[model samples]
Target: MSAPMTPDAALARLRQYGERTSTWSTATYNDGTEKALHGIALTLAAELEQYRALELGTAEGRVSAKCERAEHPVWLRDLDDVRGCPWCELDRVRAELAALPTPPEPQIPTCISCGATGGPLRPTGDRYPSGAQQFVCSTSCTGVTS
Candidate 1:
């Protein structure tokens, strides 16, 4: 486990962001946020799996008497152990999503002649004047938008 961000570092990062005027985009901060969450997601997944397995083993009583494991603890205990409340924090959630299993590639209308397939189609925020997935015409063939 890594140490939590120190107050000084966080304040410095925020101060850096304040210096910028045009757009408040901080690629480094964004990257840090994503990295932190990815670890959290993995940690949560592992914790969840461990809890489930322990539960199943106890239920089945397959765990040997000699092995001797403890009963399932309370939610608060588990949460405390796993550093819970990630759901309440935007940064944690973002990190978790960053590490989440990605959905399968979307089915797209491919250009038959050129055999060009579109990349993962996520929201680009701004609505284009034409309101279409931009495509290009090439020597192989003409392309169209989704």
Candidate 2:
């Protein structure tokens, strides 16, 4: 069997057929050929309309391929389509978390004399030599015994 005719080809053929049949006598109108031609023309017209609709839909889809983020291509109708986007939501969450104040770090007690943070430390009762009430890791740090 022959392949089906494309819309363009069918339209061209139909135009040629119309041109040829225009000169036919009124007696020929009673024959089944004109009726069959009329049916084919109606069917072709419907198919052509469907084909044009599909082509227009494809063009619109291509135009709307990119989202507002611009990070990647997405099947969205417009740039303002962030409500349904996972990437946009993630960015919003990250920004919200970043805007929050961070907790302060804990202060570790260190000996003032030797600047020693680790090991056992004892506080000297007398505020002499360094002035401020100081903690010493060992007796060797200051003359005043710990």
Candidate 3:
């Protein structure tokens, strides 16, 4: 008679089957094989969950057996073994990013003729009434203001 499959072996099998099924195409897919794999995976997962529940001895001790962010199994002994939830980690990163100081905007030279700001500014080669050098927009400017 064949030996029973261990939880570790079942997990490994599930991972192997998962990888294989992910790359399967319609042309090469087998319904029987897929169904069998699903049934086996579901049974193994349930058994594993039950095993963990029994081992932990409490509902509160029933933490996730896998890391959602990494999509990998986490052999946790207790709640302390949990690093953090994926959403919590993401929110923490967002908060840190939000806390960072935003850089100041660059000063744009103003056009003295049209009072326009931004875009290219060029010297009008003329002086304002206050003897200050005047600048104008490179396009559609009416020259220096009086």
Candidate 4:
């Protein structure tokens, strides 16, 4: 058997069937032929819809794979539509993430009055050799017992 006709071709055939049926001027309507034409039109319409859905599904699947590799959110939609597409949303998110500024490394103040490092130190409003504010390891390091 020959391969099935494409949806577009089938749709064209359906249109021609419509034109032929419309030209029928007999009082005795060929009910079978008219019904067959309607059936063919509906079949062509359904075929076109299925074809579109397959295409959209393929595109969305590709986007999902890309999202996975990029460690991005995959909001998958099976519908054959472009409105509010998850792939576009994810691309937007990626752009926003790329534009974000990374936080600076925290500066850990060290005691200038004592040899202790990373201890309970407090700033003394004095600049150390590193230009950072001077800190004392403790009150005892500042010569104060309390």
Candidate 5:
């Protein structure tokens, strides 16, 4: 499929900078830049879906072509959708796990200092640093015990 944005189209648009900007102190280029930032974020989101689909080896030529034409949240949604999806087979393990019973909870370790109850245990899935165990604050989220 075609790229998300054509470099030539971007360069062509950039050639009109002063002409577009000269219309006002902040023209389409200025306001467009802020809007472009948000636009690009959405574009990247869509691309991520396509990339994932492509990686899973399930994305069809038609689907990949459609992804090339897609924009914003709609493409994002389609990419995330699993309806008649080529990669639905990837869900088997996850679906089985979700159907299983919950395991016994791990014991919460209390904080010796301040006699604080252990607030939380950081899971491996947490966005914490590698090998870092984040203890939830005894008082509040911002409260970190030294």
Candidate 6:
């Protein structure tokens, strides 16, 4: 098999995927309207969560035959790898998220309930004082304050 990817390298792949999907929302079917990209965005979000978990020591790291293929070697954290692989630094997580490209269209509003910025948009009955459209990213955010 090919060499295993380092945690940062794996994050890079995820970043590329997210950036590419940002452009996918612009694609149209035979109807000629922009395609809905909720699914793709959700998938990216899930992957991001998974990576975050790995970095936090909340999830098991990669299993290797001789532990040589593991990314972010577990032993580097202590004199004898005491705590196992070190938790992913918060800076690395932020950097990974920042590396993703901005979506081609205007960004959707953050979910009032979860504060998530990217997801399916749900219409809010109220509009801005200027009459511009208003929407929340998650449907479950209905009664929450933005």
Clashes of each: 1, 0, 0, 0, 0, 2
- Model 2's TM-score against the true structure: 0.29
Q: Per-residue CA lDDT of candidate 1, range 1-146, in tens? A: 98897745654554444444345246744767645544555565556556666655553344412112234232222322444333345556788988987534324534433445553333334432444443323344434344
Maximum-lDDT candidate:
3
Measured over all alpha carbons after superposition, the RMSD of each candidate to the real structure, in angstroms, is 19.5, 26.0, 16.8, 20.9, 13.6, 20.9
Error of 6 at 104 (Å): 59
For candidate 1, list the clashing residue pairs, or say none. 37-95
What's the lDDT of the predicted structure labeled candidate 1? 0.46
**Model 1 ranges with Cα > 4 A deviation:** 1-31, 58-146
Tens digits of per-residue lDDT, candidate 6, 5-102, equal 88677666665655674455443633444233444544766787776765555565433222334464532122234332233555467889889875
Alpha-carbon lDDT, every model: 0.46, 0.60, 0.64, 0.60, 0.45, 0.53
Quick one: RMSD of model 5?
A: 13.6
lDDT of 4 by residue, 45-135 (tens): 6677656655555543532222444454444454454456466677789999979885432266655555455557777788744566767
- Please identify which of the two predictions, 5 or 6, would achieve the higher lDDT against the true structure: 6
What ranges in model 6 sit over 4 Å off? Answer: 1-36, 60-146
TM-score of 6: 0.22
Q: In model 2, what lDDT does residue 52 have?
A: 69
How many backbone clashes are present in model 4? 0
Worst 10 residues of 6 by lDDT: 76-85
Q: What is the Cα-based lDDT of residue 111 in candidate 4?
A: 59
